[model samples]
Target: MMVEIAIFFLLIFMIIGMLFVLEIENLLSAVVMMGAIGFGLSVIFLLLGAPDLAIVQIAVEVISVVILIRATIHRDIKERADESLSNISSIPLLVCIFFFFLMIYPALRLLPTFGEPVFLNFYSSSVYYLRDGFHLTGAPNIVSAIILDFRAYDTLGEAIVLFTSVIGALSILRYRNRKKEHNAS
Candidate 1:
């Protein structure tokens, strides 16, 4: 119950952060709010027992926020937002958003209740893994059996992707530093 309440509050925080990002006039402030929203989502993912997703979200959020802030830091973004144009565009955007919710409302209602098994009505391999992974793989831990035995290749792929991302980010940062040093000399 406490975990659910915390998730609910984090959801509310994320929504408010999103609204702030949309409405704030300052580019840097908007980027900060975006980071807050992303961090809130990571927290919610953690609370929901998906630490892998939470870690990925944190990494993506950090990199994107850094890039956005670097791009916008020297720009005069406030002067770029024309008030009259925004006023005119907001009406149609709101209308479109309303219609979008109307279209998706029925599908939302069809979703399973919170904390319920989403694949209960269908056959899912996850059910087999959860039930018999340890027995079939002769592993003491269910997670170990699932990852080491059943999904070894998938896990290897994910590790490779993460390694590539880290190397790419580091290269970009190093390039920026080298450019700065060259300019100084």
Candidate 2:
């Protein structure tokens, strides 16, 4: 019950944070709100009994926020002469958001109640992993064994993807800085 309540509040905070991020005119404040939302998600992950996921979520969130802050720190927000156009553009986004929730409402209702086991019956592969993962992979932790040994290639691929994304962000930031300097000169 406590976990459910905590999750509920965290979800609420995350939703509100996202709205703030979207609506706030200040870029830095928006980044900070995004960080708050990310941390809220990490907390929810921890409360749900997935500490590993929580750790990863927090790490990714921290890195992403750092990058975003760096990217926005030196920039100034330009005022638009046509504010009405901006407001008009947002109408479609609002409509899309409403329709998205409408589409997913039924799926959300089908989900099991909070704190209930998602799978009433475990799969054979899951049983095998639990029974033999440590022995086969020689890892003391079953989760470690499964991720690092059994799914080694998948793990490597994910790591590569993360690395690529970070590099891409950094390069883009550097390129933007260079372009700004060139234009200023």
Candidate 3:
């Protein structure tokens, strides 16, 4: 019961942090708020018995903050007054928020209550994996077996995507450097 209440408060804090990030006019402040949101999410993950996910969330958040700082260090940190949405523009924003809640309401209703058993009908599948996963996949850990053996292709695709993004960023930086050199010469 106390754990659920803690998780609920953490979630509320995360939501508030996200809202502050979106509404803040200063880019650096927004980035800091984003870090706060990430930290809250990591705590929530820990509360949910997902230590691995919590660790990954913290690592990713730190790397993300570093990257964002490097990327925006040379850019304007303050939002321009002209970029702010006028009162008339808020009508569409409110409409979009309404539709977003409308779409999410049903999905939210389908979620089991906190601390309740989930996927009760899938117990057999879980048991089979727990009992035979090592023999079938030669992986010592059940989570490793499921991710590396059962979902190898999906994991490989995600790795490929990350690799491609890194390559793309390198290429863009290289091209920019060459352009700067040419202009300097």
Candidate 4:
């Protein structure tokens, strides 16, 4: 009961943080709100008994925050106001919110009730993996077995994508530097 309440509060915090991030005009405040959201998500993961996911979330949050701060250090943090919302403009926003709730209603109804068994069958794929992962993959950790053995190819593909993105970013920056130098000379 207490755990569920804590999780609910954490989820609320995350939602509020997301809303603040979207509405804030200051870039630094938005970044900080994003970090808060990430931290809340990590805590939720921990409460859900997924320590591996929590660790990854924390590391990603830290790295992303550092990169964002470094990238925006030279730029103006305050965003220029482009448009003002009038009373008439709020009607469309209200309509959008109504439609969003309408769209989500059915999905929400399909979700299983709290403290209820989601699946009828007890011997599921997840159970099988938990039982045999160590023997099959020789990995002591179930998360490691799932990622490094069961989904090794998928992991490798993700790593390749990340590597490509970093290389692309570096090349773009390098080209910009050379262009600047040529223009200066």
TM of each candidate vs. truth: 0.67, 0.76, 0.80, 0.85
Name the best candidate (by TM-score). Answer: 4
Write down the TM-score for model 3: 0.80
When sorted by lDDT, best at the front, the candidate numbers are 4, 1, 3, 2
Please list the Cα RMSD from the true structure of every candidate, rounded to 1 decimal place.
4.6, 4.5, 3.1, 2.8
lDDT of 4 by residue, 79-184 (tens): 7565335335778989999999999999999988876756544878788888899889899999989888899998999999999999998998798789899999
What candidate 2 gets wrong by more than 4 Å, as runs, is 78-105, 166-185
- Per-residue lDDT of model 2, residues 1-185, tens digit only: 89888899999999999987766777888888999999999999999888889999999899889988988988977333453344467689899999999999999999987666755356666678788887798887777888898889999999999899889967976987898999999
lDDT per residue for candidate 3 within 133-164, as digits (tens), equals: 98998888787787788888988998999999
After TM-score superposition, what is the CA distance of residue 36 in candidate 3 from its true location, in Å? 1.5
Q: Given candidate 3, what's the lDDT at residue 167?
A: 97
Task: Sort the candidates on TM-score, descending order.
Answer: 4, 3, 2, 1
